[model samples]
Target: MSVTHEQIMLTSFDEASARRALALAGEALEIEADAIRKLHARLGRDDSVPRAVALMLACRGRVVVSGMGKSGHIARKIAATLASTGTPALFLHPAEAAHGDLGMVTAQDVLVAISYSGESSELAVVLPAVKRMGVPVIAMTGKPASRLAQVADVHLDVSVDKEACPLNLAPTTSTTVTLALGDALAVALLELRGFKPDDFARSHPGGALGRRLLTHVRDVMRSGAAVPQVAPDALLTDALLEISHKGMGMTAIVDADGRPVGVFTDGDLRRLIEKGQHFGQLRIRDVMHLEPRRIHPDRLAVDAVAVMEEFRINQMLVTGDDGKLVGALHIHDLTRAKVI
Candidate 1:
């Protein structure tokens, strides 16, 4: 028997096996969603919003977040989210803090302690030092009246009805709820401080989000000697030479005052040539698209990418509100910048 590429590629799953996998995945999603809903329900109690917000705002030093085991993992993520969203925060391992890391905590800092049981030994060892320094502590735990919670300034109750794990041993729904609550607190602080998207971009200056928000049209646009520009009254032959010199596949047709009047592209030239029109006698104004898409230099690059996609255009003319041409950007510019 000969095995072909098609035969090798056509392997199939039995119906029962496929259904079981899909059903389990859907059940897990439902469990996680329920956990989030229940957690959100707890936000209004004890004026948690005002207290948590005040705690973060009053801290002169960085917010220190700590936890043990699985809860520790969630704590680290929460700390990262807080740091990126305008609030200064860092994660400190509870065990490490007990040994000499307590030196990192200062009178001006805020300590956020995380433990599902609220009785982690490592957390217990570090509690006295955190208090001695006059640092305020916020505890996240299943038990509000537990030792860690009783001693802390604010206690956040992350109690879940049960874990999603069938064995009831793994930290599933509880961990997710705790993480969600942390995000809620961070975002609330972001709103209170009037944190803008540009502020967020400043902290994350290396990825897609950074490129999308931090990048200005002036940064990625073809400017100076690279801009394909021609006066509106110039002959089509002159516009073609500008396009060739810039290699941007199009030339901006500007009025006598230097404001963009129209755009002439390779597409326009092909159509004109097919109509037997002579480039030598035609003016750029006669063959250019009268209303080409345009964007402002101060606007986000993501917005520029959106406009390009909506109009199916390759390039957009960057302009100032004063109607002065500033620069030009191609769809490829956005792609290379990862704004796509």
Candidate 2:
């Protein structure tokens, strides 16, 4: 809102400043790592971690995570992790919850309140209302004797010896510990639910793992009239024309019943050209590689990628159970579909 003509100027940064910065950076990481280690040891010292997991898993509704300031950021991240990993969870801003957002918390829901000092005034108001609704509370805090922890149904101690900041006032180390504890709970619930890759994919359809798990051969394969095919008796030049028109680098040689008998590719055409053979007289069967690599339509597209990479082939045919040429796939198709 205000500006001054004065500014501190430095002609250059010296090695001493760089060294001090690097040292602090390394020390911060070490402090955070130690905090997480302490959090793990605390879990071993008590049954709070398992008890917290049990409450969340037993809940018929969502896990409502709430906190203030830096702890609030960690609360949001924890809610997202739990939701994506099979537990239904949401983040409720503490200040907002006291101002009517508390209605989001139901009697069947579990409240996860995060407060480093256990004195977040906003959460103090929400805890009472949530308690009245018969909702259980899981509190994460640095002070076990703090009011928030004392009132919680389950207490998770996320205490850290000191902050990574030189002033020992910032929440760097404590926040990392809180976030990690939340992840541990989500993963525990995930394991208990027997959540599989497909289940995770359903919730993360836009992610890479989701693409690999949910995209099927039929989804990426060129099917129907788009597949490049020529009769086994067709001329080699005709197969070449089919390959060029379809732009699949190859053409399938199918029998009268539309079953793939073989495949002729650009490599075949090159060898034919080198031999100076009469492309005009040669049939597709004359140069076709018999028994083309094939896959099922129902298989995951990632599985098709494996088959293509294993055989070192760029093109593959999709065959039905009766061995009919139902579709085709080129490596480029997988790339276009973001399945590669």
Candidate 3:
């Protein structure tokens, strides 16, 4: 693996090209970020945001979002964000709506039409029908005097000074502003409706927060015969065997009442060996750690994770109201359950 003269020269040229590309990327990101900031600034002074939110908040049916070209892509994303965040929303392609999908809208629904130029002919064909149905149309456009804006019930001005594109012809900054406004509308509606995390979990059951909120200790803990345990009088060898047989890497030292009094892990065995203590001279009660961390079966599994992370322990005991050991948990259990 040696570099030739041409290869070295090519590497130098590639570095310069890469630098230019990175600078361009940074500029584009900055431009998009500035557009969002401007949108945020306008939100403080503009009543359009609150008015649009009110319409959507009062809507009995889903929010029907429509756009054309690049705006259409942003509209679809906005609809997904709205739906996932408690507002019922779906994207309706303008061309498709003109063809037949306009029937999906109703008087009970709110229509959010996105067009940078506000002169999308495809959207124009469907706007009249939506207006005739008495559905409230929230127009997100760069031009306030365009046909779509004139026909809309609520006009949200999403104009940007110039696009991030070098030619200033592409829908870059304007689309970003429109999408930000869409998110602003959805967030406002959700806030006014008092939507909670549990509500969001129900909407996104497959997401990380959903798993944490919905999964319980009983659902993931090792129970019954799977829980590793030993009597206080049990021999160190016997406890070791219990831990090994259960594959929990630890065993709970229980009283005659079957309640865990202490816990002994493989770490304890290692320390005993390092101290030159013979296994024959030790009892489970003598070596085990007293009053181990424990959680209730009904508590969320995420709570268990917090306890383990705070105490820096890998295993936890699950106890019932009777103070009897019902189950055990290892960090591996959480990993396997995808709760960690």
Candidate 4:
């Protein structure tokens, strides 16, 4: 069929619009990437970066992060990152500092002041009081000689060549650089403090990462009567009853001392049926798989998940140091707990 004139025109317009959109996106990404590259280049030569990190490391009290407007937002995020990483920190709005919030800052603390333009008036207004309190300041600014930078014990240059915004009036590249610098500071302190994943999880208990790192097998496992279990000499039918009652798709076969010797799962029952074996006549020991996969109650649930996935099984028994069955958990339990 021949293409209509209107169809060709519409297709061309759509292609042109898509090209313009993609070009604009590419330009914006290039500008931001260049800004990051400049920051990366400066890292090797900037002695002030290490000085700031050292000062923050030596702080006996919280790091008071203060800034104005857009800088204030970045300061809050920086403070949160620091707090979560092992460095105790809090955000102090420069404007609010003039109105008694300055009391929150103590001489024991160090201050990190962020301002792309080193002349933020609100920061200027409160910085004097911070100085009077004898708190050392680390300044993040574009201008090395500006008032804020001059007053600082250490000044980190987060200056970018140009704004990512087409008009170059908005704080885009500058804010990104400032945020990146803040992250650098936090991570440096984290490394210096030997902050581990457990420490991070402690600070972020409500997050998925915290759950994965902190949740132990005992926390999610079904214990006592809820754990499907059968004596080694129990009938295969009895083991099946326990599996059905616990809904774990498996039953642990334990010895007289309550130590798990083997496990019988729904899959085992299926295999037995396929072999034309009679379930009524067999004991659990006759049909159970010896040396079932087991995990310690103290181990992380995420580790249990790895075991389950590695063995291609749906459930595992939680055993004590002596290998006695203490609990059991199905893959569904891990899924429900968001530990998978």
Candidate 5:
């Protein structure tokens, strides 16, 4: 088929269109990045940022985040982050506050009000009432001199030089800055409260991270006779049989007291084969790896994974304080539990 002049022009226009779209995306990223950088620079100069965090930390009740329009959307996310990071928080819609949702705010709660202009009409109608109820307000806004900022106990300046939008009307850079500032506040409060990973894991128990932190070795380990084991004096062939029957790719070489003296794995079989050793006659004690990696039943399953990864092994034995083998675990167990 021969291409017509019109077809050639259409293809050129399509290519130009793609290039323009990519250019616009890059410009938007640059604008947002610059806004964040400005926000970062302003952090040290703004005393209110620390004071706001301190207020939230001292709050006896939840942090109630309230805003309007795009700011409201950001406020909801901020509340979620705060709640998840150890600070009790919830989002309250300013528009709903005037219609009696203001009852959600209590004197014990700290109010975080967000408005780029610092003069959202919905917020204006409710702030005085919230203040009257003795709820301290922390205002996040671009206009420091605006009514919302003036009335607030604390003001967080989230001003951007310009919006990422071409028209400079739609909230893009400003909203980004506001979201980042909210995250900063939440993280600061998290540090102040000494929120540990274990505590965070408890709050996020449904996630893979929670499984890693909360699941104990005993929870996923094979206990009792299911744990592959062989006497140290047992023939290599017998150990191999135990490994095969248990399907753990390894067997613990235990003493008469049932204490793990060494481990015999598939890798040991490979090494013995390469050395032309007779598996039928060789004792497990002769070829087993001593000082095998082991973990206590109470240790985190994730810690078991760390040991396996560090030694490049697939299985580890679980031992009691007396060094007696109580259980065993394989890499597949961690994979199944999503601890890896």
Candidate 6:
């Protein structure tokens, strides 16, 4: 068998073709960026944004997002984003709307119809019924002068100068621009509604974001007898036993008034060893870390994690408003709660 270098055996194509492809992509990106930048400028100068914002706020029911073909995919994503971000929205497929799905929309609802060319026939079929119900239509389209835009109560121009596709036919850059525009609308609505993290958490209760935003220290902290605790005057050996018994790697030391004075950990035990002092002869307060990191029971678990990170601590004592130890929280507790 003849030996051959893998590099030498590799097939080659016209290098200019690859350069041309990249050049087209770069040109398309610049064009789309310019288009979006112009749109942003328009947002600053326009009264239409306030009008759209007011109309959405005044709506008594859900937002109905509708489109056909590629626009339909974008519309569906927009609907999901709106629903997740405090705006009640649903995607209404134009083809299905003609087959009685139009009933899902009502006078109380606001319609957001997406059509890149502003000329989807399937969407047009339901326009008369939408008008009859006296519902407002917000159209997202590249051609603002087209029938859909002309018929819409509010026309949002999402026109892109070029497609990222080399052939200049496919919905590449145009789709990207439209998707960004949808995000712009959804986020604006979220801000207009004063949507807080807690509100978002309620809508996304099963996700990590929800857990971090909604869960409090009290919800995850081990309380009462579960918390490893020792008196300030207790022997170091006895406090080590309590720490081992609770398996929290540490024990809280409280003063005569039962307020947390310090914390003793296995690490503290190691230092006691280095000092050549017998555990039986020493008190927990003599070897414990004073002014230990502590968190409030009512605080968010994510905030607790931030405090722990800032102090370079792995565990914290949960305290009540009265400055008494209520619970012990390990870093793993936050991980389990998805707050990490």
lDDT of each: 0.87, 0.91, 0.90, 0.91, 0.93, 0.87
How well does candidate 3 score on lDDT at residue 181? 80
TM-score-better candidate, 1 vs 2: 2
Superposed model 5: Cα runs more than 4 Å off: 1-15, 44-46, 233-237, 273-287
Highest lDDT against the true fold, candidate: 5
Which parts of model 2 have CA positions greater than 4 angstroms off? 1-12
Best by TM-score: 2
Q: How far in Å is the alpha carbon of 323 misplaced in model 2?
A: 1.2
lDDT per residue for candidate 5 within 58-92, as digits (tens), equals 99999999999999999999999999999999999
Q: What tens digits encode model 2's per-residue C-alpha lDDT throughout 108-218?
A: 999999999999999998888899999999999999999999999999999999999899998898998899988889999999999998999999999988899999999
Instruction: State the lDDT at 143 in candidate 1.
Output: 89
- TM-score pick, better of 1 and 4: 4
Compare candidates 2 and 6 on lDDT and give the better one.
2
Q: Using TM-score as the measure, what is the rank order of every candidate, best first?
A: 2, 4, 3, 6, 5, 1
lDDT score for candidate 2 against the true structure: 0.91
lDDT of 4: 0.91
lDDT (Cα, 0-100) at 68 in candidate 1: 91
Off by over 4 Å in 1: 1-45, 231-235, 253-262, 280-296, 303-312, 319-326
Where does candidate 2 clash, by residue pair?
A: none
Alpha-carbon TM-score of each model against the true structure: 0.80, 0.94, 0.86, 0.91, 0.85, 0.86
Model 1 agreement with the true structure over 1-340: per-residue lDDT tens digits: 9988767555555667679879977887788798788777767767865797799987889899999999999999999999999999999999998788888888889999999899999999999888988889999998887899899888898988778886778999889989989998999889888999889989999966777788877778777677789998898899999998888889998877778989998888898879988666888888899988999988888889888888888998988888978899888888887788
Tell me the RMSD of model 6 versus the true structure: 3.2
Residues 234-263, model 4: lDDT tens digits: 988888889898898899998889999999
Clashes of 6: 0
Which model is ahead, 2 or 3, in terms of lDDT? 2
lDDT value, residue 271 of candidate 4: 91
Q: Each candidate: how many clashes?
A: 0, 0, 0, 0, 0, 0
